[model samples]
Target: MKLTISDLAKMTGLAKSTISGVLNNKDGFSEKTRQKVLQAAEQYGYVPNEIARGLSTKYTKTIGLVIKDIANPFYSKLTKGVQEVAGEYGYTVFLCSSFEDHHTEKEQIQAMLSRRVDGLIVAPLLEEVTFDHLFDLKAKSVPFVLLGSVPGLDSSYVEFDDYDGGRQVTEHLLERGHRSIGFAAGLPTSRASRERLRACRDVLSAHGLALRPEFTFEGAQELADGVEIGRKLIAMKERPSALICFDDVVALGVVKAFQSEGLRIPEEMSLTGFDDIDLMIFPLTTVSIPTYEAGKALARTLFGRIFGGPDTPPQRIVFDEKLVVRSSVRTAAN
Candidate 1:
């Protein structure tokens, strides 16, 4: 046979409504009733029918999270923050990884909608992607907030100040009296990447220095990709004395490639990276984005929209990046 709420109510010798109150953790249930109902439910292996509960309440009490890649430590830390906050709100989260692909991102959103999730928290893969999916979300009345930018969209988001991050690293290298700096740039589609590049270029241009075409290499935000760029940079006839990697993941590969080519970091050529991720390839000098805090903030922002109404005039919060001065840069050698 099958078990149901009635069975639980019968086993606990409580009315069905009383059992329900305990199950939902509603405010009125007595402590004794709560304990008795919980014990019976566990003894009988009682599992609430989510579909029926959702139908009755018109809310599933579930949130969906879409990330670029779970393999990245940044996302792993961010998910922890999201889960902690969501748990406090009595909401369960469904996590999906888009792997930075457009079709996959769309599919994940569609799947979440089919489940009638109460809300969504998406870290959009905006590089070279159209905003049609976002427009679709608005059309379908799905409440969502971006974890990062999706250029030209007025969606509420929490993002790192990549422009300042890039400027800070570039300035640090320049302060060390290094002018011929190399840039290990990331995905061309990432606005964050572009922002960093523009800021660094602008800073260099202002100081009467130019980012030579030969000195710029594609970093691609991956370790192996960074290594390839590292090899290319090392082979250059006249290489920059310092390099700015796309991000820390790519920087690791760059470090390995450079070391293999008989070069030492901050000794022969200084290097900097972005996102001071834990377990970095080295004690790298870079800009730091607080991923965990960003995750917590993302959850809070999503709930604000869910309760405050869809037309609550979405809010945007851009966090500042800190310049972490590690042992990667050369004073002409800090």
Candidate 2:
């Protein structure tokens, strides 16, 4: 016989609301209460019927994980972190990729909502800045966490210091006596790109350096795009002696691009990247953000909000960026 919430409550000798609170991890229940409820459920080998639970409580112990592009390594790391915690909590995750398409993002969100996911984790498509769908979610009281910065939304988020990262990379090149530095920025689909570019510009201006219009380029976070941008920059008449790529994927591409053109690393041109992707065994100089840590922190914060009640004063968690110095970057020779 399938056990119901009522049966579980009866067995635990707790009120229905108390059991519900325990299941949803709502506050006001002591840890002892929670443990008793859990122990009773386990002892009875009780399995929650998702459909019945949804109908009775209007909650689906599932979360929607929407990202702009999963092909990027950074997002992949975030996914790993989220999955690790979600597994421990015995919750399921529904993965959705927007591909930076707003229409598609909207459609996917609707689908997830229709399925009645309890919460959402999103890396919104910046171009499709419509929050009507999100507002509807809020109206339904579904918790949502934004990955990176989202304008016009006051909610939970997890992001690193992109501006400082850009400034540090640019400054590193400047200090190395490389006045001409190239920048390979990602698609303008995210605030991360904008902040990084702004920092680069600000640092350059502070050093009385001119940011050549030709030295900047934007592309998708694809290796091919990175390679193409690298080639274009290196082949210019007055190419930069140093390059600050958007991420390590782009830096790897720059390395390939320079190699194809027979340019030596740190000899003719120096290269640096961000996000210290795991497979980069060649020790590329770059900024490392513990993406896994970011993901875990984001999950913890989100779970806290869901159970501990809405946070006042807007919780903002910022992490420090580390500079990984490797052989890829070097001081320019006179």
Candidate 3:
């Protein structure tokens, strides 16, 4: 037979209320009494009835995490940080993938709510202008954070400095004396993709350099997409002296195409990437975001909202960016 809180209370010679207080780690219980109730419960092998406890407290102690895709190293690293912090705080994270789609993101959010999550942490997929499903969770008073910011939404978020990341790559190439630069952007609807693109274009414009339209490319954030873009660019008669890729994973494909066509890196055309995904063919020079630390911050922020009550002001944590210099780039001497 399973032991109950009543059994522990009887053994400890304490009232059920006192036992409840000790079990929940509530205040007002003396340390000595707290230990007495705890020891009695431990000796009797008392297991908490989570369902009953949730019913009484009106909180499930679970959090929801939604992202674009887990396969990407960036998202995977972020998930690790979230899982570590969530476990330490005695909470389970319910995860979902938006697949960068509005309908899918909405359905996943509804499913997470159905599971009675205490709060939500999402890397929302939004356009800079006119996004769908932006208000799905806005009406609810539950605590939530976006891994990235959304336009016209009043929620706390942890956003990477992707705009600066884009500029760093372009400026790195320009400072090396390469005037003809190119950008390989990811999905058009993705805000992350757009921010990076805008920064690169703006920086080029600042230097009185018009980013050549023919040298540019846009594709999925996939390895094959990288290879195709790389091939097309290398074949151009007036190709860009340097190509700034969308991401590290796609950059792998880009390198493969270049190597296949006997185009030596840096010696012929320079390349750079974003997100700093590990285990690459060459030591990649790219913009590195604090993925793990940001993940920890995201978890901490969500908990603040969960326990801090309705009046707690939202925390918008913006993470910094850095340029990881490696052997992948060289000076372009004209």
Best prediction by TM-score: 1
Per-candidate Cα lDDT values, in order, are 0.86, 0.80, 0.84
Query: Model 3 — which ten-residue stretch has the worst lDDT?
Result: 127-136
lDDT of 1 by residue, 203-312 (tens): 99999998988888753767889899888888877778999986888888889998898989878888898888988858899889898999999999998988888787
In the range 267-334, model 2's lDDT, one tens digit per residue, is 77888999999989866899998988887776766666666654433456777778889988888873
Q: Any idea how many clashes model 1 has?
A: 2
Check candidate 1 and list the clashing pairs: 330-333, 331-334
Clashing pairs in 3: none
Off by over 4 Å in 2: 1-48, 128-132, 310-313
List, residue by residue over 231-252, the lDDT tens digit for candidate 3. Answer: 8877778777788887888778
User: In candidate 3, how many Å is residue 228 off?
Assistant: 1.9
Candidate 2 lDDT trough over 10 residues, lowest sum: 306-315
Better of 2 and 3 by lDDT: 3
TM-scores of all models?
0.89, 0.83, 0.87
Give the CA lDDT, 0 to 100, for residue 171 in model 2.
Answer: 85
> Over 4 Å off in model 3, which ranges?
1-22, 25-45, 128-136
